[model samples]
Target chain A: MRFWQLASFGGFLLLLPLILGLNDYYIFLTTLILLYTVIVMAWYFIGGLAGQLDLGAGAYHGLGAVVTGYLMIYYNVSGWIGLVLGGLAAMGVAFIVGFPSFRFGLKEVWYALASLGLVLILQKIFLLWTDVAGPLERYIPFREFDPLYMRARAKWFYYYITLGLLLITFYLAHRAKRGKLGLYLVSIRDEEEAAEMLGIDTRRYKLVALLTYSFITAVTGGIYASMVGFYHPILFDGWIGIQTATIAIVGGLGHFWGPPLTSVILLSIAEYLRINLGGTIPGLHQVIFGAILITAILFKPAGIGPYLESLIEKVRKR
Target chain B: MDLLIDFAISLARNVVLGIMMGSVYALAAMGLALLFGVANLINFAHGEYVMLAMYMAYFFSVTLVIDPVVSSIINIPLFFLIGLVTYFLFFKRVINAPPLSQIAVTVGVVVLLRNIALVIWQAEPKAPPFTIFSASYEMGPITIPLDKLFATIISITSLILLYLFLERSKFGTAMRAAADDVDAVSMMGIDTGRLFLLTLGISMMLVGLSGSLIMMYQAVTPTSGLLFGLLSWAIVALAGLGSIRGIYLAAVIFGLADALASGMWDPRGREIILYGLFILILWLKPRGLWGRR
Candidate 1:
């Protein structure tokens, strides 16, 4: 029965674009929403599961982007290959930074700040490394339709790709949640000192979570770069990391479906507001976004996920 | 021989400039340190407040046709009130909340304040044309702009005044006592809640003063908050919780880095030098250079 529900949800998303006859604009919007959803879902590893509150999603995302974009632009590598390479690059950097950070026991605000600072450092590096990505926007080759290269003019093509990635992400997140890794992470998050006392080798487990999260986030960046057909140092956006964390927290941290659900709903509202009220008031949409976040944190600190799970439990009981 | 001498001169010139700029940075970081030490609140929105104060400075300066520094008379009191209101409305609930929830609330403030600024200012960098000290004078081969000079003087003076207040005043003792032991302080017939209110107020007042001083020469952009925010954190990390003097020294070191980076290296890479230093410090000496505890 649970399997059927999951399959139906997957099937619905697979046919969403076709069923709605969403134009290119809508597909593009949905794709943007899904891309962020993947980032927030990826946050579940280090943030929700490990309780790290890692805010450096932009660092990994940007690394993935620059590597993939640079490989495709300069080396003529297919984006499929670029995407894999991007994920690997992100994982490698995560390990390098994560090893020291976890070893030093950088937790709470210090860890968050360090991660946030990483985004700015990487952005500046790319900006100054003029040969690869300077202050200027580097354009990727735009093809009318090239599936072989993962370049396409149609928006749905990228939408389907993003959707496929999102499904894989869901599966991975599900597997991770139910596994031994998940059990270790729960202990590490709730009681780090206790977990360490229990001989959990907390640092390695945290690094593993960081590496996994970074790899998935980097793939989203690669897809983003190809879909947009351009990349810049600005792709290394710290705001995206902050927003991803916000969405995850608002969706109810630690829940499998919370982040993705909140991501889609909130992003759709943001897009609607951007279209309707953006021209007149400029930041009306974002102001509403901020209000929603604050209210959620204060009133429903458990997040929307717990309520959702309880409802599902009742239905099962019935 | 000439090129080498010229290099030495430019390097010396940058050192002088960095010290002056670092003074103002000390003033900015001081507020954050106080908020951290006293309130125990990790204010992610510290830079946003400074950004908003810059806007306030611009608003007052433009309307009154006065120097931006003069606008502190209004900005300080106004920000103090804003601080009190925020303490009551937002911060009071999160005093004992976990760092995660505190961060969430403050990050919420960042989003709200930034977007509010965007709505009001429309992303354009606002700079009032009024300048009280627009002259520059030469001391040997190094030149110092009078505007920056006055800004530095004002910054150092404010730092001294705040230091004195913390050392000499009755409430200052109470605030310090709260920092050391909030429950014990409250047990001694002191209102720690009011102390936190004042602490937040004073912290915002420092931000107001720094904003006015910064507006002496620089323009206020929406993104300016992010830059200043990270800068304050970097300075605090470098300074630790030892003393105000540490904050000053660290800010100056940061200023020199800023000066050297922009003057000697690419101007765009300054953040790399600064935040790179911040991460390194976090790894090596998370207790900071002057940290006593």
Candidate 2:
């Protein structure tokens, strides 16, 4: 990474707690933003790089949450171990769906629809799998603050952990974007036939992209379940999928730094809207938020990424 | 044999309802099919246009105390103008843009329209004022609604008119030519831009008509478009991309399938059955029932 990028990220981390100390509400908002940032970065692997719009992030997220919940409840596993197992299970499911989709030449809308179906299917499964999943929210045992169980009584710990995860996900995305795999994926996105003609193993590369995406998203899910201390079918709702796509698109999709930036700005705006408009008007906040999205899309379809890049270019020229 | 008779009666009632429901599906899918077939845009926000039509219907009913049936006539032209404006403002610029960008734009529209509805109307479900014809009529162990019958008739008549317009008229021919190959049609001295706007206007008007008709039987809400949108997508996909008659046939089949599943199983399982069929159909025949290879 560039010197400015590293310095900015480091400064943000160092200053996050200091800012959080100012208000409890800001801490909660910061943690939520970090969690969504993790999910958006995960989406970038397949959506931004491979150009496959997988609308089924909720499926992997839900699966990871269910796995963590089950491990914690039945087997009494530590949250740390549960997180790893949750990620593995999510990856296993991704491979099953991704392999068939890639091999069969499903691209664009077909892939988007198929991935959407995965979330619906998983939601049903979680609903019916009453024994392990439980009908209501499954809670992890509350204990004193422990790094081993990954359970914390305060928001400060979650803030740091989520920040750490965000950094790792950023690094991974940056590496992929700079690597040969990134080149192949971009080629597939731009023109599949030409890429194949140029001897790119499109299917293999896509599968790799999908696996990486699922693993990162699943990890986010694990952290989410622990932080919230509950898991339910509602966690995998279709709206979540829509929100994932919205965050990525709004942030300037296909850019290395876009998703996180978008997540922070949009989530904060949504929270602000909810706080102000939600009490008096039940759904007005959503209305204004939706309007913002529509205006952004109508006017700034390339997202804030290209605009920011141009601004940087102008500065360099000066 | 009474059991058999009951089953037969139930099936007949459902079949009629399915056909009635299919008419609305046909209208909703027409605009999306036109856009996808001609311009190759999936248009994730296509349902929002339908929602907009419903709100328009509600507005006319509430303000002018006009019957929804009468308001639908007004909506046709009004929504057509809105569609035209939308095309000029947003879609026209991105006609040949990348698919991801197209999806993003439409999704943004969907979010904006849905949120607009929430702001203006709140989330409370609203229904357009209905006349006596909106109620159900009992015919000796079977129930049928007059509004649904009217909706079906109007739907079929409009579709037939659309078919004639597309197949026989010069402008329709120009639109078809543009859809087949925009560059080639432009080379042949046709204005492809005008054709796109025309297609968009007509398609959105059809969706507006369906929205008015749908309010006769079901209540309208902000999120109501989500199910209808998905159903229309399923119908269009099943019918093949560009075939009007195919959309009609596919909608009928899907409506019947949906009715049958609801009758045979719990209502909650209806989505599962429909989506399962969608996956199976795509797996077995990716081009759709009538889609060209």
Best by TM-score: 1
For model 1, residues B21-71, the per-residue Cα lDDT tens digits are: 999988889999998888788999999999999999999888898899899
User: Residue A221 in model 2: shift from native, Å?
Assistant: 2.5
DockQ of each: 0.83, 0.43
Interface RMSD of the candidates, in order: 0.8, 2.3
Report the C-alpha displacement of residue B255, candidate 2, in angstroms: 1.2
Q: Please, what is the TM-score per model?
A: 0.97, 0.91
Model 1, A1-318: lDDT tens digits are 999998998888889788769688888888999999989988999998998988899998998888888888898899999999999999998898889999988988889999999999999999989999998988889899998788898888889898888888888878889998888998999999999998999999999999999999999999999989889999888999899888888888788888889888989988998999999999878999898888888777778888789989999999
Q: Candidate 2, residue B122: CA error in Å?
A: 1.9
Best by lDDT: 1
List per-prediction Cα lDDT, in the order shown. 0.89, 0.80
lDDT of 2 by residue, B1-293 (tens): 99999889988888888778877778888878887877666688887888878888888877988777677898999989988888977788778888877777777677778877887887889986655576788998889889888888888998999889989999888877766777898898877778788888888888888888777667789877766777777787788876788999998888887787777655555667777676566655678888864
True contacts kept of 1: 0.81
Measured against the true chain A, the candidates' chain A TM-scores are: 0.96, 0.94
Clashing pairs in 2: A287-B115
